[model samples]
Target chain A: MSGVAVRAGLFEQTDAGVTLLGDRCRTCDAHQFPRAGICTLCGAPDPVPVQLAATGTLWAWTWVTAPPPGYDGPVPYGFGVVELPEGLRVITRLVLDPDVAPTVGQPMRAVLDTVGTDPESGHDLVSWAFSPLDASVGL
Target chain B: MTTSEVVVAGVGIHPFGRFGDRTATDLGVVAARAALAEAGVTAREQIGITFCGTAYGGVASGHRVMSALARSGGPIVDVEAGCASGAAALMLAASAIRSGQHETVLVLGLEKMPAGVIRSSFFAPWQEQAGLTPAPAYFALRAQRLMATAQLTTRDLATVVVKNRANGVANPDAMFRTAVTVDEVLASRLICPPLHLFMLCSPNAGAAAVVLRRARPDDAGAGSVRLRAAALRSHLPGDVLGEATPLSGLAVDDIPAASTLAATAAYEEAGLGPDDLDLVECQDTDAARELLAYEELGLCGPGECGRLLRDGTTAPNGALPVNVSGGLLSKGEPLGASALGQVVELVRQLRGEAGARQVDGARVALAHTVGRGANASVTILTR
Candidate 1:
């Protein structure tokens, strides 16, 4: 599956499991989260891609009892705000338990999960997710 | 700032309990009738505009209800901005009144949250897929942050519930009047870590409506509460992923960005300072959040809200009464209706109608409401 040409939406996947391929702003040098077509900080065209780590520490986490409205994801899933070493905090499902009690200062590893698919277009949408890594299950 | 005058010509609230005799629409019609009667208006036919705010049901939901009331055809609009939807619609009505667009406007909020634990697929696709629901999650995240940085404990937060529920007990309008203990709050089923089921708002079905118009000749002389300042803003530009990045180390204070924008705009509009506010309707989706709002809204110095709670400063008879409406925590959040209900309660307090839990001489009140996408609104009322 490594070279499966996984119909990515033109964003680069980090070896650390972060799927957002982003560019660095030449002006501000700020690293963007989701891959950008241009430097969001400077409006500079064609920002470059920088590989990121697939794991981060759990800054905070919680159980999403009810998703907002009209989200078709599985119920009772755990979600957390993971803090990547690169300095971005992003939200993604913690695919471990319905009761993933993500405390402060926990270790988290990133992965790609299927978000949804459009039947008419037949394209699969994938997004980033994180899981707490057990000490016995180190990444 | 020059102000456009308006009055709460009438008010209505359906009872807050699980009675399956009627649907959300039935609940809405009931409140609508009560409002028209209280306003001394014959029908929606006299009203030039209609605004309904709800998040739980159908599209064109408000319009359908307007038609049900048999008073359609002016300009029926739908407003949904998380829990602040009702307040947002009221902002629109106030705007219309000031501009002389319409004299009498009916603004109502209705919602019927499915029974029991509020779970399931009701989120933005990215958010739902990522797993950050509403209320408890945000509150838990804020609580965790407070625990990490503010040196607050679950016990301090529990007092918010104890006080608000006690406040709810006095108001027959509140849903859960049975007061609970901090130990009870601590022992309840954990929704997220320190947050327990008791510490959070209940999911209930209810509708609250308000009728507004230009004040009558004698109405301004007595028994009328006037609108002061109404300010609403979404969270200022910032990445809100509660710590998915290296920057998660920064506290809301350190950022000095999101809440600052909202507080500045709110205070500026009211032409008042935090010192001027006698009572507040701060968001308390959970106990932790109630404390955070104290800091964020400048009621206390950052990181000292726990001190305020533990010392009984935010209690019912405290210096500044907070959430005399039992807040979202004790009263439960019905999405669209919850925030506006906060406004209604503030109007009651400023009008000296809040019977038992009434602030002794509440001359000014603030109602802070938030919606999805980090939007925030603050409304101030004075007697």
Candidate 2:
């Protein structure tokens, strides 16, 4: 597990709730994540910002005990495919109860998965993780 | 109907598995050499373009492979559409050849998943500290949402494993050649809630290639298959919203819409309907996606996919005869190569090269592949 030190994106510190983010093509009205310069839909290029919805339904997902390379983290993580209300489906690490197994169409809300920051680069990579909307974690 | 003719002259595949012996470059070179050799083309002089496919190998990976092979120094580009990388390369190669850019082009798919826990954008330093890292959680969230919205059951997904495993049993080249029973699949260790280990495709390593050009009677041999269409529809950013109407303002992020969008594009581009297809190679890295694929590819009525699977509609000899080559579930996911490898199998089957697992008289075939990025590629092939 990566140790915690301050000085990251700090986006997770805010309680704005995880809203799936994307760019809506100013020219063609298309939305996507990671913000692409090329408008993949109509090839118009230059997609402006259009914040996606916070709530979405779960599609299908798989548990990746083994992550991809360069990912230094815990084992047995829950990676989910979320169908945002925006029509964009996303894959993210989820914040769900361990006993809870979400089906095809369960309601979920987004939460910022705060990956600890690198004391070096300072580009705190934050994850937008989804939580089962029905149940709240007991703090 | 578009009459642009492009056929798969040859396809080469290296077995998918961890090879401590060689690097990804070696794997790619082997597949490329195999493809060139199979086409019986002595020189790369005839090839005008190359689209080398890889996701996690190295920077300028394609250039390195081509330069190492000493093949076509012609314009070469690398494609990284996540899981659809190979098919994306295939699409680029096909377009180049059909547009008269090159007489023959090679599409190579290769990957060497470095030994480690694969951390992606899903979980990085921030996600890990927040208790997020595994990819299955991302997919699980999707499954959870689907079950609630679609009114489906976990057993509905078991059919995917059942069908694919049965299909895989006959494939010697399959990574997991053993056929699995529903009970066995159901009993396997759970990766995500309701999703079993048997339902998941492992991270594998391998390389696959296909060389495309104008149809040559002597080359695809008397029986080789022709590439009718290679369609790639990248998801439009995050939501891939479900658009019900221009005015309703209700966007549903249903899997079928995305899949239908891609599959429809491919079928239309090829001028063939679902009925004209003899087989389907939909992505089933996990089981739930397989059911979604059934609807996305128009193989059955929505909500009736579970019924279709129960009734054997998607079995090897069933109405659509889907995934006869053992989907990613049984085949193991060397993500980069798996997509084009789907094409390789279809090309082999259409050309009477699939051997025992060959669908009796399959003249038309379709291959669809997807990744965590939700990128999709569907290619239609005919003999």
Candidate 3:
């Protein structure tokens, strides 16, 4: 079944795969995910939009057993921090098999996956997540 | 800032636990009145101003508390910085006294939180929907990194819970006063990888208050605790990986954590270093956080926190005890009251009044707290 992106302007579905949308400071070259109007580092106004890297290394990972308020996601979901080559670390969900445990420094590729269901709309909510590059199967 | 001395004339608390039907104002009034009585301030008009810290407390929280105490008509400001709310209020109150704006000020911290996991508005709606707002995931992720880099083990984490829970047994105001074994802590339900239910602190109700006044030359031998330093700092731009950062950053390791910045500023302001401290009360929202704080506060070198616990260096009877009031792990965190509760504990220890949990010869003590919005605060007290 297909799903809708949880939030618009955060990622794009291109022919190549899911690519994150971010903003890079024109003055200091600092990159930020989820986009920003101004550079957080140099305070340069009007940072330009850029496509973040599609693959990165897992910096950290955890299995969240309890769901947060207003979150209609499945319990025991995997969460992680992925460090991209552009020096930006993105907090994303991990698409992993039930038996597979994630390790740091593992290669990860961005993918759009269902994170939860919208309580009001009853529609599956999709968000950008990281999957192990070596995995032959997808969640 | 002027060189005027600001002293803590009195401190009070409303105990840390769930209080059914008791409003935040009720807790705040009880604590405030106790502090005022201890300070011998019968004339309500003598209070120059009031600063109240709260995160969950609604609009005009301080005004409601002041009105209940019949201490209205004075300037009452409410401050909020997540868990560092109380420290932020205390910092402003001390500054007012030092700047000669107010000769005497009352600082109060109170909270009445809902049950279960802490819910914060720090994250955007999308992030919350993505299952990122409960906060334990962030702490567990941090712990994962610490284990890989700092050689911290799950055993070490359990040991921290054991130590703090044992210490809580001696504290009457603490919520959880029973001690648990390391094995028991590890066997508890795993909320997240590397963290168990016992390793985390509960969000509950409580309040703490302090009376700060300009010190006089004649007050030398009256056993007053002087506020040597109250430094609050925010996260640097690239400190997304730090303790309080809710979202992404430049992910650079060069930027110092908020705790480090606050601790450095406080050490400089107080003209003291880690060696001069006799006791410490630091943020222990989770077991791993306390270990990280030891490094951030310069209490030990990097990669040495696990050793600090294994060697019993931070035990209650050890030199330079930490969290003798059982810490948030035992006392339960009320956000607003957490930092000031630490201050109240320090005052008791400095005055040789911390019953069974007293640290012998605690002349210089420090209280540190860091929380959401990437804010950190460090307060140093000397008798």
Error of 1 at B293 (Å): 1.3
Tens digit per residue, CA lDDT, model 1, B1-383: 22367777777887665557677788777777777788788865788787887777568767767767765578878788666777777888878887988888888888888865555333434444333445466667768878777788788878888898888887777788888998988898887766888888777777888888866666665567766665656643234532112112222235643344566776887688789989999878778777878887898887788888888777888899899888877678777777678877887787788888789888888888654555566777776
The per-prediction i-RMS, to one decimal, reads 5.2, 7.6, 1.4
Per-model fnat list: 0.34, 0.32, 0.73
Model 2, position A112: C-alpha lDDT score: 59
Chain A of candidate 2 gets a TM-score of 0.76
- Ranked by TM-score, the better of candidates 2 and 3 is 3
lDDT of each: 0.69, 0.70, 0.88
Predicted candidate 1 versus true structure: per-residue lDDT over A63-85, tens digit per residue: 76554454455556565677766
- Tens digits of lDDT, candidate 3, B1-383: 23399889889999999989999999999999899889888888889999999999989999998898856588999999999999999999999998889998999999999977888877778878877676888889878877776798899999999999999999999999999999999999999888999999999999999999999886677487899999999887765567555456676766788999999999999999999999999999999999999989999998788877888889998877889899999999999999999999999999999989989888999999998888899999998
Evaluated on CA atoms against the true complex, candidate 3 attains a DockQ of 0.74
In order, the TM-score of chain B in each prediction is 0.90, 0.89, 0.97
| Candidate numbers, best TM-score first, in rank order | 3, 1, 2
**CAPRI-style grade of the A/B interface in model 1:** acceptable
Per-residue error for B287 in candidate 3, Å, reads 0.2
